[model samples]
Structures are given as structure tokens and as C-alpha cells.
Target: MTAATAPTGLGEAHTVYLDHLADADEYAATDLAIGLLDAGVPAERVLLDLVAPAQAEVGERWARNEWSVAQEHAATHISEQVVAAVSAHARPDPTNGRVVVACMDGEWHALPPRLVAEVLRLRGWQVTFLGASVPAAHLVSYLHRYDADAVALACALPMRLPYAHQMIEACRRSDVPVVVGGRGFGADGRWARRLGVAWAPDAPSAAELIADERALRRVPPGQLAHLADDEYASLVRRRSELIDGALAELRERVPAARAYTAAQLDATVSDLGHIVDFLAAAVYVDDASMFTEFVQWLVEILGSRGVPVGAIALPLEHFGAVLRDFPRAARALALGRAALPGVAR
Candidate 1:
């Protein structure tokens, strides 16, 4: 069934599952998922319908600042446990070739891909799930050793797209067909197209794509001729300088920032770095919306935590001014600036 129509009672099961996650009751969460399996609910439904949606809500709660990092971590641990419990209960033998599932390097959000891996296993693929932040070299080496039919890479954040491209290329060099998924590829997998890789919107689609050898390898070449401009490269080389300058500017112009505690300063630095990294990724893909979308997300995240719009406005303007000679980077920053709430274009 499509996302709009979850199996009967799965909606209420989702609510109860979320409550269990919020309470950090791992035992209850596992029991609830296992209980579904016992009640004749498909294991795939247990994962995609029940566990997947609940994990997404966990992220939403964390993003809205309603859940502390510790609480979110606790909830995620329980979800992982539930996945393990479900996988063990529905141990399907492999009838297909091996598929290696992993998160892209520098991407620590492994749960989304973990769910995908389990679904592939349930569908009878000899799935080997390599969880979280796998470097490209090690991944290619492992693929060679394991004789993988295809490798499915996961990237959750857009900022990791550059690295994702690198990993995809590494897999190609090793003669392994690659299929990528997750938010890093964009909601419609447009960025994956930009990188010229096969992309699946979700687990089932990924399974179907992996099963279709001709279709998986027949994708068009990446449309990255924009990289010839060198803007993306220059932005990467100057990331450190850009973040340092932004932080210094913040300290000078925002008096409150000058007195920020250690944790606050680190977080500000991280936010500045994220802006630069996301802008660079936008430049890589030649999409202004990439940067603009990230700007909106950053604003909401910081705004929820009591940061003023000016705090974000200043950095966008600063990046724009600093990258004045780089047309694509400057233009992306300008579009990002226009996206800020209450900010004049």
C-alpha cells in the first residue's frame, strides 16, 4: 500500500509505538512491533509502516526542539532494537544476489538506510548492511571482496552530496552498479540525476531497481558540466576561511555572540559551516533551490531555539559579499537570502 494508505490499525499502532519511543521503553516498543508480527501484520508493514514512520516522527520531534538529543538518541536505539526484533522474527532466506547497503561517508544518520536494508532482506536479497559513515575506499574494497551485485548508498543530508558523488564514482570504478536513496538525493531524486546515478525513492523502489540489471545500469550521464566553472571547487577550498570569518563577524556585530558560552560558540560555528557546505553543494548541483531550501530549514531550526532572523540574515549577506566574484555561489546565496522570513530581497 502507498504511504497515504497504511494497513488497517497500523495508524493507531504507530501512535502507540511513538509513545513507547518517547518514553524510551525499548521493551514495550519491541513487544509492540513483535505483537504486530504475531497479529499477522506483514513484516514489511511492521518496518515501513510502523517503524519507519515512527522513526521519522522521532526526527521531527528532535528538529522542532521538543526532544533533547539524549531523548532522540534513546528513541533511535529503541527503533534499532525494534528493527532487529522484527528482522529476527521474519528471517527470510536469500534467493537473490548480495546487495550491500551503507550510509555515505560523513553521514551518521544510519537508521533510514537500515530500514531499507531489512526490507531488501525480507524481499529475498542476500543483503549485507554496512551501517553508517563508510568511507569510499573501504566500501569499494569491501565490494570487491564480497562480489556484490549492487551497492545501495544512503545520504540523508544534502551537504553530503559532494561526498556522495565521490562514493558513487568509487563504486563505478570497482565495476559495481550503484543505486542511491534518501533525502540527500532530493525528494524527487533530482540531485541523484544531477550526479548521474540510479536513485530509488524508497526501499521497495530500490529493491525493484536493483532487480532490474539493464534498467539500473541504463541511466543517463550526469549533468554536471557546471563543475567546469570551478566555483564549487573554490568554495570547498575556502570553507574554513568562510566559517571563521562568519563567526568573527558575528562576534563583532552581535554583542550577545561575543559572550557566548563554549557550547553556544561551537554550535554557531557548526551552523556557519553548514551554510557554507550547503551553499557549496548547491553550487555542485547547479540548483539555487538546494541552498534556499537549506536556508529555510536552518531558519526554522534556529528560530525554534530562540535565535533571531538577523542572525541568519547576516551570514547569508556576508557569504554573498565574500563570494561576489563567484557568480553561481553568490547567486545561490542571494536566493537563500531572499528565502529568509521578513528579509527584504
Candidate 2:
């Protein structure tokens, strides 16, 4: 679509890029981005307004089961490539200071932060985009070696708040305030405030925060303050036992699971382990909703894989039986199980 003939400005660009992304056509996607630039669209507008909306829709398509796992990955990869292609044409920034961007450990969603990195660079910030699943120790170590004006942490899942908290406190201990984004911290970053750190809702806001000359001196949180009981710690110690028990029960109950190839079984086992870890984290934070929400999302993911949502109920029920004595664990498992289709609340 030509700039003048297009019905709207950035809106049309979003449509064009989305069409190519859905088809996993990298060159078309890159060409569309360049076309927008030729049409006089600002680089930041193309990155945030056009590409961001398209990427959000790609995620929604996956959530609605309109795209397979591989399709989602391919689309996201193409989007990443498109961002790089657009950045290649961006003018160099001379005034922006160094800033580090990273995702919380266990947060596999890197696209959002990567978008922020490029946007910040376009806005004249020297960005070090540390891709997905960065461990807190590694991040802390990196901070020691590099001097950054601010660090931006991305967390896309509520199940990751515990680790996000850890990373925030770690940064605080070193007197480096953190700027947090992504859905995991809630819409307004309520969790980030609870952990006593700065929260930026998006890339522009984050860049604005980083650019502000005012000092950011957030107080570090006390150690182990969020945890109440040894139950979470105990559960973590028994994590292997829990996953093994749940896997064995699923193998007996799910014929499809029993007939799976070794690789598939390994994936299933890993999924179960993640559930256990998230449950333990929920108990540690005294929130059942985190575990319950993860289950609801996991149900959709499994549904995309052709697995019945109700099959997940068995494992939740099994977890309830195994952790019956722990009040938080029991409630978390019950809420998760109840969230499944046809399960009682």
C-alpha cells in the first residue's frame, strides 16, 4: 500500500507487516518495514506502533489456537528479523547512555524486551540486549562488569514474579535500581512496587525513565521477607519426588501420554516439573492466583497441542493429594484443578 493511497498511516503498515508475519515471509516483512520508512514513517513509529501491534496479534493467534507452536516461533523469529532489518537503517545515537535489558530467569518471552532495546537505541540509548532466560547470578555479574544508567527487566508470566523479585533485590543490593516491564508484573506494575523497584509499562516509558537525570535510589528488600513457611522450601527439596509421582499417575491414566515417544515424554516431564516449581513459588508468595492463572494459560497451550484440558485435572488432583498437608499448596492445586473444564470450583 502506497503512503498517500493508504486508508490510514501506521495502521496500514501494521496490516501489511502482519500479513507477511503470518505467512512467515521474512523478506516481505522486512520490505514492508522499509516501505513504511520510505513513506516517511518514523523508525520508532514503525518499531513500536506497527511491529508491536503485529507481534501482539501473533501471540493472540497462538493463544486462540489458530497457530501451532512452530508457527508461533517462526512468526516471532521473523518479527525479530524485521526489527533487525529496520534497525540497520536507523541513524546512530550520540547522546544516549548505556542501559542493560534482560528477561527474568524462566521468562522465555524475549521479543518484548528486544523491541524495547531497539526502540531505546532509536531513541538514542546505548542498549545491551541480553536475550531471554537470564539467570539472576549472571545478570548481577554482568552489572558488575558494565556501568549502566539503568537496567530493564522483562517478565511475561505471573509465575515468574518470584524470580523477578530476586533479581530486583539483587540489583538493589548493588545500589542499581531496576526498571521492570511485561505482563508478569501486572498491568500497572503493582508487583514491581511491592518489591520496591521502578516500573515502566512500555519501551518509551522505560527509555524516558532511563533518560531522566533524577537519581533512582530504591531501598533493597529484607531477605526472605516474602516467604512465610518452610513449606515452599520443603516442596522444592521434594520437587523430584513430586514430578515423578505426578508423571507416574499421568502415565497410568493418560494412554496417549503412555504411548508417547521418549522425546515427548521428556517434554511432558519437564512441563510437570515447571508446574511444580511454579506451585512452589506461588506458595512462597502466598498467592493462589499465580498458580491458577498459569494453569489456565497452560490449558490453552496443551489444547493447541491437541491435548484435552481435562487431562490436566488429573495432575492437579494428584498434586492436591500429595501436598494435602500444606494449606497453600492444597489451595493452589485445588484452584488450578477447578479452573479446568468441567471441574468443580
| Number of the top-ranking candidate, with TM-score as the measure | 1
Error of model 2, residue 26, in angstroms:
1.5
Best by lDDT: 1
Candidates in order have lDDT scores of 0.92, 0.82
Please, what are the lDDT tens digits per residue for candidate 1 over residues 1-345?
223433247888888888888889998888888777877899998999988988889999988999999999999999999999999999999999999999999999999999999999999999999999999999999988989999999999999999999999999999899999999999999999999999999999999999998899999999999899788999999999999998888889999999999999989898998999999999999999999999999999988899999999998988888999999998998888988899998
Each candidate's clash count: 0, 0
Predicted structure 2: lDDT: 0.82
lDDT of 2 by residue, 301-323 (tens): 88887887766787788889989
Query: Which pairs, if any, clash in model 2?
Result: none
**Model 2 regions lying over 4 Å from their true place:** 1-8, 213-228, 254-256
